[model samples]
Target: MTQVNTFQLNSSKDEAQKAAFQLSAPQDDCAVMFASPHSGRHYPDEFQSLLRVPLMDLRRVEDAFIDQMISPVSELGIGTLSAVFARSYVDLNRSETELDSRMFSDGAPTPAGERSPRVEAGLGCIPRIAASGQDIHVRKLSRDEAEARLQEAYRPYHRALTNWLNLIKRRCGRSVLIDCHSMPSLVAGRRIRTDIIIGTRHGASCDEGLARTVENHFLALGYKVARNIPYAGGYCTQHHGRPLEDRHALQIEINRRLYMDEDTVRLKPGFYKLQSDMKALGLSIMNWAEGTRMLNSQRT
Candidate 1:
């Protein structure tokens, strides 16, 4: 039997258990599903001692508080899925086969498929190190240990996501999986950058119409939004997005500097503003998806 994790969202005499991911609805039938794969913070104590950097610094790569922002999307009548296992523990956006041979003592079998540049950079299914290129541990882990994590953490998250997407598609006859993520405040010290990056794998992951609807929402808010630059989607978007099948996936990357103190990792004064903007955008996207054929539209 598959083990399911039970969490409470509201008052109810009877309890229900979902998988590691969660779903909330307001009884409104919306065809969009929101997902935050790298925003998890449930780090295991056993992995703490292995970290070469401080715990606070270790989380510099994490999409801090993203779960808090997207959690309310459920109340807007859409489904929201979030991973509870920290990205440092196991990244759900990566392919299950993306194991780093160097991270294991006996080495690992290479994954099938074109070797993604991200995996080559040590951000594979089993990352060799955390962000900042800091080594995760002092010694190489056993292959069995790596495989165990794949079975226990990596596989379950994707399995849950797949099942959820399948259900949404069944009900709506079409579904959009917005894979939510947050990027570093500054990468290689670029002074000016995009406020949001909506990646559709350069139009392979989602319909152009859907992408335009999302992109316009941010543009209407007067926030700078870019397409397929710096980020053109990651594993989640690449793996699941299938516009031909009427299931589109888009990767939405919000700049961390907008809502949080990059150094302190705390919500900034503009945090509420950004959240409000997202709320408005979310509503617009939901409404647009309900009545329009976004699959037929294009931004430029």
Candidate 2:
């Protein structure tokens, strides 16, 4: 294990109402950073007042407790960044440019050609609908409202992420971002439910070996692991993953059914076991990073 002091800092409520995200750091930095962009549960009053759907419906979209699942990484001397604002408020994983024009009264800045499939499905940066297809807003929003969310939440989160990754890289010569998420047990018609899915955008986001290492970690735990099936990584994986540049990003999606009561959004009996397994996984990755450092030293 990497030896370092243990420190955790949460934003003051008065400063920004518990910050847009919580950053936990170890005394000595390592090559890995864990991020949970969708696990946020905070719903601001202004955002809640416009909702057409019930709060429970919006909660369905959260990765729910995933941040807590990966919280063990901080104990292993790896840093973690977890969003405080709910994903329904503004998705930190999405590109700021992914705006759905139809949901805004003033029209989106993105051209039709630039709209992604996610946007078409109403899962853009500012979501138009929940994962269950319920319209989120009772009325169309002004462009200013959308922009404000991005300015207040989205950009700052990414800025902090980028800064952390860069600082880690400078200290360790490389950096890896593990973007954590959770998926519903059943996705409409899908029958071959997997316990875990690791996405590297078909090897575009991170080195194939790194992806395989993560896959193997889960497989070793006797869990059914799939690669790039329904999910092949998202914006965070695509945007930040650059293996050639010594910056790698991977997305890990845990089946919500594995650790939480899906309908109630509560922890399952198996939650502790799952968390322990993930902690072991993080330690394995840290060992791999140590080996990489040795290899880089040998080459030099």
Candidate 3:
């Protein structure tokens, strides 16, 4: 059994446990799935009860319109799984085990190991601080509350993701994952001039050739490109990527300023062009999948 068919519902009862993620291509037609874990914007009422800072402040942490940006890829037979619940509510990019002991009533479902640097910085699976460094909840959460978010949001999303990837592997002989995300144009008050950053976990997550090919696509499109600097991907890239199993995961970070007004959290005139470019990017991956499938047949 793969990671798929292994996770059981942690149901402390989330309102939309089954509906939190939307999978557009259940058929797995192209053997590629574009997932946007941080693009979710929905803030549940139960979550609203925990708010300390204004919601807009928390919104800054979102990948913003990345879900919509990757939506077009489904048209080309790439499965798309979009998390609809807000990342501030429960970051899907993080490990459910990455908890902050201080955030919970009983010191959390505390990690059995030392806390990771990101968790210490308050960016765990259940985030403690907003993008602006403001606290998210006014009070410490109950152990049940923390577990519910993990069970409801984190586990379900991964369950569906793993199942889909395994299915693609079984049916197509290869599986590809394009983990979609957006980065702020400015970090720590400095501008990031690169139009895109592609991360393959220093080639651990994917073959260097495929990573280079994807990077070259954006570069040929006149976009400045960077590799593994500042953002080298997160739990998703590290966990799902299994090159030995013929499964590859690559993370693409789009500069938000290229498509949206950051302060207002609204799309700019550039969003459409970028959306179009995303469709092209998906097509490129599909073409690669086809070629890879053909080569595998020859090898066999």
- Model 3, poorest ten-residue lDDT window? 1-10
Predicted candidate 3 versus true structure: per-residue lDDT over 16-131, tens digit per residue: 43466877763545778899998877777778878999888888878988888987877777788878678998999988878888888776764542389988999988999997
Full-model lDDT, candidate 1? 0.75
Candidate 3 lDDT at 257 equals 94
Badly placed stretches (over 4 Å) of model 3 are 1-18, 26-29, 110-114
Model 1 has a clash total of 0
Q: Which ten residues in a row have the lowest lDDT in candidate 2?
A: 3-12
Candidate 2: tens digits of C-alpha lDDT, residues 1-300: 432212222212333444677788643557888889998887877788899888888888899888888888888888888888889989888888888888888877445414889888888898889866889998998878987888787988899899989888888888889999999988786754799999998988887768878999999889999999989999999988999988899999999888888787889878899889888888888888778778989999
- What digit string (tens of lDDT, one per residue) describes model 1 on residues 135-177? 7777887777777667766777788778778877777767788
Give per-residue lDDT, candidate 1, residue 108. Answer: 72
Model 1 residue 86 lDDT score? 68
* TM-score of every model versus the real structure: 0.87, 0.92, 0.92
Superior candidate under TM-score, 1 versus 2: 2
Clashing pairs in 2: none
lDDT score at residue 225, model 3, on the 0-100 scale: 97
TM-score of 3: 0.92
